[model samples]
Target chain A: MPSDLPHSHGRRQFLKLGSSGLAVALIPVSAFAETDDMLAAQAELFGDRPVQTGRVSVDLPPIAENGFSVPINIQVDSPMTEDDYVSQIVILSPRNPLPVLAQYHLTPRNGLAAVSARIRLGGTQSIRVIAEMNDGTLWSGEKETLVTLAACVVL
Target chain B: MTTIRLSVPDTAERDEIIQIRAMIQHDMESGFRVGARGEFLPRDIITRFECFYNGDQVFAADFHPGVAANPFLEFHVRATDSGSFEFVWTDQHGEVWTDTASIQVS
Candidate 1:
């Protein structure tokens, strides 16, 4: 028996089988793994609708000595009327483990489309505010600050 | 547990922005680390906050883990009537705390 033809043919078969096996092995392991779980939830709220910039503002101290109790305020431009008004205001932090910090729901009866609160930060990061209107439009604003005392640092 | 104070002015003018203030004592852990154990503490968060006028919800918020501990939120709201105003905070663990004060329209 000539070894040339059998070896060539067998080599082709081995290469094909090896490559296909590699592809199959990679699929399930990758499927079960997740780099970021919070990203999915964050994207679900902000993915389809491109967040518009402006008409809302987030205020924070330029430098915060205490990350445990940093004051934050979100103000959105709205008439606060029954006919047309802001439906909700949401606060998001880009670097926080749970990014969406706080949210306020408003109606015409409330008469104010602003919310004030204190937030904890792990480090220096940008805080975002997304104001959702009754008509289904989202307006965004951001503020950056330095955190001298990082929140979440265990030891 | 600590006493939380909430106040709305007695002679708050209508349509005229009136100051509202709240102060609460809480451990607002940053969930980053624990001092003694040298381990990351699980995130504990306040999920909702509400302010009521005459027993009606006037302002509300759904808070997250980023909120600092012992939070105090102050803002302005128009006083439409003479009644008691209430402030309430609910944590993610289902703990609820509240404070109230009377408001009089002048």
Candidate 2:
């Protein structure tokens, strides 16, 4: 009975350590789950298309004083012609309550593929913009912004 | 329910890039916060925005709960012809807010 007691005690300690290790592993896994959701959303929109990392520029303050009203300007370098214009622009905030922020549909009539707006940020995160050209090419730009006063805080 | 203020230049040169700004008075409640009574508030927000020039969509946006209160949007459009620019905002309640501005291109 004395030997059995020590074995049971060791098993209990092992279970305790194992559960703590699992809890530690789960934290990052949950965070990765959010990232997976973001990727899935992107795939849904672009269909696994390879995204080129140029031709689109996102301008925003490197440090945002307030996430509630962060100003953002996006410009895509394109000719804005009937054959070589930006057809669609999508803004995404991966860590926000929603990953997709806004989608702008454009045409040659727009004459420009630039847009400026005030957006809310949940915290310090990257703002990504993607442009779909008339020739079916996809270009992207991203800017990481540090938010001092976090917005979208659920209490 | 909110009031929208749309601003567009009265006149511009043909083919000029004219700036358009739209502002709306809205709280943009994200519905994730708790009320004073400790109850979860329902999310109420503007979901979509579109700009039309001479009956053609020039720019549009899909808004989320992450957008700030009293949303402000500024964009550019080619002043090809003298016509009206229509702006529309749709909310979570399925309510649509609309405003229009006329531009004269000489």
Q: lDDT by residue for model 1 over B1-106, one digit each (tens)? A: 5879776777876776676778778766556656566667776766777888888887777766677777777665767888888888887789998888887786
**Model 1 error, position A119 (Å):** 1.1
Candidate 2 wrong stretches, greater than 4 Å? A1-31
lDDT tens readout by residue for model 2, A1-155: 57668889999899999999998987766566666767777898999899999989999999998887899999999989888999888888777767777777887887878888888887887888999998888999999999888776743
Every model: Cα RMSD to truth: 7.4, 4.9
Interface quality of candidate 1 as DockQ: 0.54
TM-score of each: 0.77, 0.85
For model 1, what is the error of residue B70's alpha carbon versus the real structure, in angstroms, after optimal superposition? 0.2
Model 2 pairs whose backbones collide: none
Positional deviation of A20 in candidate 2, in angstroms? 16
The interface root-mean-square deviations, each candidate in sequence, come to 2.2, 1.7
lDDT for residue A97 in candidate 1, whole number 0-100: 68
